[model samples]
Target: METPASTATAETPRPVDRADRIRSIDVIRGVALLGILMMNIPYFGLPEGILGSLKFDHPGDANYLTHQVIEILFSGKMRALFSMLFGAGVILLTTRKEHSAGLSIADIYYRRILWMVLFGVIDAYVLLWTGDILYAYGLCGLFLFPFRKLAPRYLLLASLVCFGMLIFKGHLRFQDMRGKREAYLKVVALEKQKKKLTDKQKDDKKAWETVVKNGKPDQKKINDEIKNVRSGYPTVWAYYLPINTKIQSSVMYEVYFWDVIGMMFLGMALYKLGVFTGRLRRRGYLAMLLIGYGIGIPLGWWVHQETTLAHGDFGRYLDSHFLPPNRMTYDIRRVTMALGHVGLIMIIYKSGWLRWLTGALAAVGQMAFSNYVMQTLICTFIFFGYGLGNFGRLTYYQLFYVVAGVWAFQLVFSSLWLRFFYFGPLEWAWRSLTYWKRQPFRISQPDSETVVSSIQA
Candidate 1:
């Protein structure tokens, strides 16, 4: 009789080979991974307090313009694309497993995601990056398995529902903030007369004051945060951990969960509809590109214009975010921009003119897991206190120099690394842990099939 080890080997599901990888998905993933850095770099290099506020730059400044470009073109769009790609990966993985005779899908699936959760914790805490999305992705991924087999239409419906929930939640939060602001103003008017304040009135006044302070951050707070971020590792952790905790807890559930899940469902729907597989006609992609940008760009511009008009007015800034038009259209702008980006990328892929560029992008996408982590490591060393300590030193446009440097390095490194190795280091490790076995590491001389697989991907 065969031993238990042999039986387990025979039953265990294996990772997909390079030959089976979808080039379009890989290209998309690569683009999304790189685009994410455009937004994340500011947080890494600047004091957190100054972000999304007019504290750092006057209106119409070059720095402000740089921010506007990124805010409109990339910002949430990249992350949305990332979330959708993850959703597509779910479908891709399970669909492949359907033919894996004797394999336990749930056993493999849950184990994979659980390990991702562990990795996410490591990415956030150990790596000291508060903006890590792996944890949120892993958390959202748990619910995706059950919905894998749903039809495209049903998936689309579910996605819409999730997006709708986010809008509803935004409205409710806006109402609460508006009420507090009104109360605070009323208390202020009363105080002008030197009248006694009720306890509730005092509390209301305090709450709105706190909001104002956060929204229109003081220069001293920014300076102090800069100093803290430029300190040693322990000081950095202590200063930032509460931020991490709050983001991982309340913010994750309230905002990221719905945002991520909605994109995920949309991704699954698009995958079933062949959006990422080059199955959609060229004209179809063109329409998506046109329509997506047509709707999203103007809306994003309007929102940004209105918000920027607030300048130093805390209440007006709050109104911009939580009030009509801007509040309601946030999801629409992000989603449509994300889809528009996809269309543009897909059009490029299908055109097949820039083989050299697309090939490099595909390689980067293949090792996106590694590249993402590498970005964290490289950036922390470049900006954190213990390393070069360039935190808060770079201006907005100047930050992109760092981004470009990183992009060049990753593109080259990912392309070169794959030539010698079958998988990226982290990808290899993740696969090993998920399957509970060591996996092949180095690439051998390629056969015809391997070459074909490489070309196809």
Candidate 2:
């Protein structure tokens, strides 16, 4: 009879070969990172909600076209791709360690997540970008470790369940909004008729009024917000700091947690299915592109048009509500577009037609953490009062010029930095802190061969 350890060894699947880094994953990650910057640039250069409010009054205007294109192509898709990649990274790290060391790496992984959370807090609070996703990513990562061993089918099913829950919650919220609007209208009617309102009715009317004011802010209020953000650093910081705290707590944990975790689970399932490893057939990839784009692009375009026609009014009613269609179909559009992107990137990688560009992208992916932070630093310097103080100045189309410049810089800098160093600056620090051992930084001549092979693999 075999010993229990031997029996368990036979039963469990062997660890995957992680010695050779997957070049395709890195390339796709790089693409996702670049796409994310495209979406973030608007937020960086303009006041919050300005892009959403900018009316495309004329169809021929460049700004209107730019807004439409960004909404259709980039909005949630890049973030979804990034979240999925994070899930794939979790499996890759934990399984590789288990395979090589013959033991669980839970303790070290937890430490890594803790550090990531710390970094996220710093990024959000210190750097002052209220739109930071790192904090949410860090928090969600803590919940992912236990599910590492789940089967791919179960993982996908769980993801769908999570998504369903989000959709259900959204429906409930929409209904609640409708009820409030009806109640508020009744109160207005009573006031017009010179009838008295009960104390409870008065309170309900006040609450609904506040909601309406916030959802559809007046033009003067929008201009004031723009002026405030365009003012000095102290003024802008004071205005946004409290808002950031609320967003970091409620929005991050409440509204976005489901979306992030659902994509992560999908990512893990895809990874297990060999989708990210270039193992899927060309026909399968082609099908993903066809079905994904066929459904996602047109639906996204419809939402964009609907939202634009509403002039960005965010009311409760379907006809009057700003971007209601977009809100309703957000997950479906983003996920399908993300799948389409993955299929496109995989095809490009397999063809070996753009090795130079892919290689550069892989470098950027390798140092994603560093590049992400660097983007915040650079953009804040450009737009914030302490730096160039150009906030609320650039138009939607002009923002793309800044994005293109940053992309060029990051591509060149990442490729150059990796040529000499073993890891990106932040990645090195993160690894050292997690492992409690200082990792090697400078690449020795002998190590150069390994680094090149890893990059090219």
Candidate 3:
């Protein structure tokens, strides 16, 4: 028998070998990584302030059609899917470590998340992508390490609670908007009658004015933003820093933290149920596809249409009672759409008829971290002032061309890169940081090029 110390040394945990990766999960992750760009490109290529305006394009325009298709099919769906995958990843990492009887799980866990936090900062400040999700995910992941072992039911219950909180918060916002609109109307009536306004009423009128100003696109504001985005690197950094800080701080907690943690909990529960592992039957997946799409598509369409109509008038958009489905069904539609995607991807994976497509996607998924960062680099280069300076120039529909080009490049590059290497450049770096040692970066085996092919098989 070996000594305990020797046994510990022999059993040191390492990154999962490529052969052990679940192909379906990788494929789904790749789909999400690629699909997210469809939504993110608007932020990368347009004035941020105008993003909230529903009337970005007139009816029958290319932009309007593109917006409709994306909103109905892929709005929040990709983020939800990505969040679930991250949650599943937590289970995958901890379970493997536990089975191997390696070092303390918390030690490795926190170290990994902390490093991710650092990366998120770099992605935001250095890479100049303010919409980075890693920082928020890292923050939420801190609270997730302890709950890994919870039963699926309890984990789901926790997820539902988080989602419920989000819904309640959305309702409160709607009510607040209603209150502000009411106050503004009251103040307007008093002013028309030449009566004195109360202090509260004056404040409310001011608040409503602020809302309308922000919601309606001001050409001067848009011009200023475009000019700022087209300036040199230092100016660009200064312009975006506070915005990045706010997103990473308050907006992160108030908006994204709950969304991420809830999906994470749900993902963890699904993993425990073996859903991510392709253990769910074909009929079950079919049912998910049908029910999820059936519910999500209609709801999303209705919400989008209402939003389009309401946003045509800034005042109408701010009137809470104008649209019933706006924020109320947000979670329901996104979650269901994501479920539909999961089922659809699972069916394709199990069917094995789309090996060519799935094979490429799996390769992309395998290196998702590197690819995600790569996108930020590429988009910034194309649109930021220091690079191509195309910011605020592309029409809304034209943004997809950039997205498509990036998708093609990443699919091919990631597939080819992985044939000779065990990990993507960033993934290797991240693993090295997490394990406190440099990992083997290249594949030594003669058959390494066939790794993705095996998944296709």
Candidate 4:
């Protein structure tokens, strides 16, 4: 009979072999992480509602134009790219350890995801960022386990089906918005004629009025919100905690779950097809870039124009909001653009034209968990009342200055830190928790070769 010590040793999970780490995946993940900051900085520095409304207090200015460009290009694409990479990562982790000595891959993966969820809670609530994705990713990851074994084509099909469901849901929302707008207009017409409203009509009118008020916020409310954010950390947390809770618990599932899951499925398909391995023909990547940009850029530009044209007319704006033209094509546009980015990056990586740049990005990707949390910490300190007290003070264009500084710091910091340590501090901790054992932190001379060759490979 085996001793208890021997039995416990047999059940310990093996670590992921670093030699098999794919550099291109890291490069893409690095790019996605950086791109995410471009979209997130607006929320960090300004009101969240600014992105949705066509009319801004600073309309037609450089800041306004900059916001438009970010919306058109980066808003959803980076997150989609990140989700896809995560899907690919699921397969990588599971299969790589399938035959290793340990618990079943599924058991280990579930534990990993559970830990991720815990981290996400800290990120979302304690960190006070409503846009946190880690929790959502962790929840959706549980759904990806069974789908991991599906063939590439089937996985791609399932992804498309998921997006189809979102589009269908969008259509329903559009219809509901149209109905509300019609009811609001009818109530307006009755009031103009000095007619009395029924009790139900009175309630409907009140609700619609509230919606319109929120959609086109008055200056006082905006200023008050800014004041609250700039008051101090305790005030900021008190204000945002409930809002973040609602977002994380409900809105995220209702609006974003399908989008993320679909992207993950598509990502897994792409990985299985060898797209991330740099095995695609040059022509294939060229076609992806051309076709993706050809459709996405023009459509995005048209949406921007329509949104601008609809400003200042509440009814028309409400109509535009209800039937956003982009709803029909949002997934196509974002997915294509994300693919275009992938193609562009892969070409750069394969050509070896900018090893230094790619190498730095890969390092950032390797330490993505640490860098992601660090970004939240740094941005919250800079903009929230607790630190710099600069919330809502900067223009959209000015916020990019902060973004650039953070990017530079992370890139340089990630590169230098990796030189001495095998894993990032957070990565090391996450690994230790996942495996229930401490992982090596310092890079020995032989381990340094492993890191170098992994990058060169």
Question: Root-mean-square deviation of each candidate, in angstroms?
Answer: 3.2, 5.1, 2.5, 3.4
In model 2, how many backbone clashes occur?
1
Residues forming the 10-long window of minimal summed lDDT in candidate 2: 10-19
Question: How well does candidate 1 score on lDDT at residue 298?
Answer: 89
Clashes (N, CA, C under 3 Å) per candidate: 0, 1, 0, 0
Please list all clashing residue pairs in model 4, or write none if there are none.
none
Which pairs clash in model 1?
none
Query: What TM-scores do the predictions have?
Result: 0.92, 0.88, 0.94, 0.91
Tell me how far the alpha carbon of residue 441 in candidate 1 is from the true structure, in angstroms, after superposition: 1.4
* Cα lDDT, all candidates: 0.85, 0.81, 0.85, 0.82
Give per-residue lDDT, candidate 1, residue 98: 28
**How many clashing pairs does model 4 include?**
0
lDDT of 2 by residue, 1-457 (tens): 8998976655443322224678788888889888899888888888656665553656768888887888887788999999999999889888763321332488778888999989988887788787888888888999999999999999999899878878877877766777777788889999999999999889879888887677553677668777776677788788778978998888876678898899999999999998888999888888888888898899989988877665544442443663246567988999899999888888888888788888889889888999999999999899987788888788888989999999999988888787677678998898878766576687666366655653543
Model 4 Cα lDDT, one tens digit per residue, 177-296: 678788988998999999999998888888777867787757776787788888877888888898888988778777778988999999999999988878898778877878878878
For residues 425-453, write the lDDT of model 1, one tens digit per residue.
Answer: 99999888877778778767876665545
Highest TM-score model number: 3
Checking candidate 3 for backbone clashes, the offending pairs are none
